[model samples]
Target: MPEVFTNELNLFSGQLYMKSMNEYLSVRRFLGLRSADQKDSEPELSGSSTNVMDTETPNLIKFLRVLTMKIRRNCESIDKTHLGRILDHRTLDDSDFANGMDMDM
Candidate 1:
């Protein structure tokens, strides 16, 4: 029915949809579903006798900075669309970011 189709469209057209898509992609990347080019782009871990966190902290920070920039660009792009206007009614909270991190852990 038209109503059913409309409902489905609504379900997938707003901030919730965007969040879900972002989470899915993040999980996939964390699970090593990345492309060859992406693998090449990543910095290699050193085999030096240093703490793992010490070696990885810089890379993690750099990756987060780049990811935040890309997410901002995407949000800007989405804001130009009608769906963005609809989703603008909702606000994001720190919990959203924390939730994503918890999932990764």
Candidate 2:
């Protein structure tokens, strides 16, 4: 039979164990589970659990400016595909911004 080692003996599995532990810590931290020896600093579920709106969508004005800068940076000589992609991103950003603003009222 294989001899079992203690949890503290994470000597064999380094990166994998650390990654898993980080994930566990994140979830437990988010859900207000702290170690027995540590204090719980997270707000209670009633106040912290409420979902909030995402108000940080890509800025359409900034997107347009960046797209224009990229085109100008290339001496107005960008390929059709790159230009198309920029246009598409601009359109999507504008639509997203408008939709988010509509929800403000």
Candidate 3:
């Protein structure tokens, strides 16, 4: 995991942590580097993620719904293009980037 996300994880709620993780994974997938990762690559964030996603607003990160169910198992297994938000501002569209569309940062 990158320091930008991991550095503040202790202060982050489970939901934010999960979003950061998912976003990191999504970037790796976007770059086609998932297959190149080694077996043990949990760099900074320690412990299991089993209880990290405990959030009151479960829909904040909006995990891709499958059959009306958001997956809780193997959460790292899902690499989705998420539109991360900012305060009163828009974020780059991951879907557009994934589809080879230009983004203006």
Candidate 4:
């Protein structure tokens, strides 16, 4: 309904729909589709469907150098109550960037 009524539809949902359609024939169009090639463009997607987040988690968890520094600074300055909303686990005083997750890395 949101897709039909508004332009502010979730971009990620649209992306996932398109990705699924491209990866699986069941999700693809049965008519009015024109392709110049017999082979599928996404040969990599042939195997069992994988969790999208599993593939993307590594990239999502890492940020650019400057952004990482800003995050660290914010973490250090923020109080425990406020910071707890953003973090899964919290320390009493200084910000814990998760076990073994060094800011330098």
lDDT of 4 by residue, 40-61 (tens): 4433223322332334533432
Clash pairs, candidate 2, are: none
* Candidate 2 per-residue lDDT over residues 13-85, each given as its tens digit: 2211212333334322322333444444644322221222113113432343354445433434222322233
The lDDT values for all models are 0.35, 0.29, 0.31, 0.26
- The window of 10 residues in a row where model 3 has the poorest summed lDDT is 80-89
- Off-target runs (Cα >4 Å) in candidate 2 are 1-19, 40-105
lDDT of 3 by residue, 15-105 (tens): 2222344454433333222222334353322332322333422442243223112343234332332323221123333353355433322
TM-score of each: 0.22, 0.21, 0.18, 0.19
Error of 2 at 78 (Å): 56
Candidate 3 residue pairs in backbone clash: none
- RMSD per model, one decimal: 15.6, 19.7, 12.4, 17.1
TM-score of predicted structure 2: 0.21
Model 4, CA-based lDDT:
0.26
What TM-score quantifies how close candidate 4 is to the native fold?
0.19
lDDT (Cα, tens digit) per residue for candidate 1, span 1-105: 443343334433332222444443332233223323345456432221122243464464344334433464453344432223223323333354444332211
For lDDT, the strongest prediction is 1
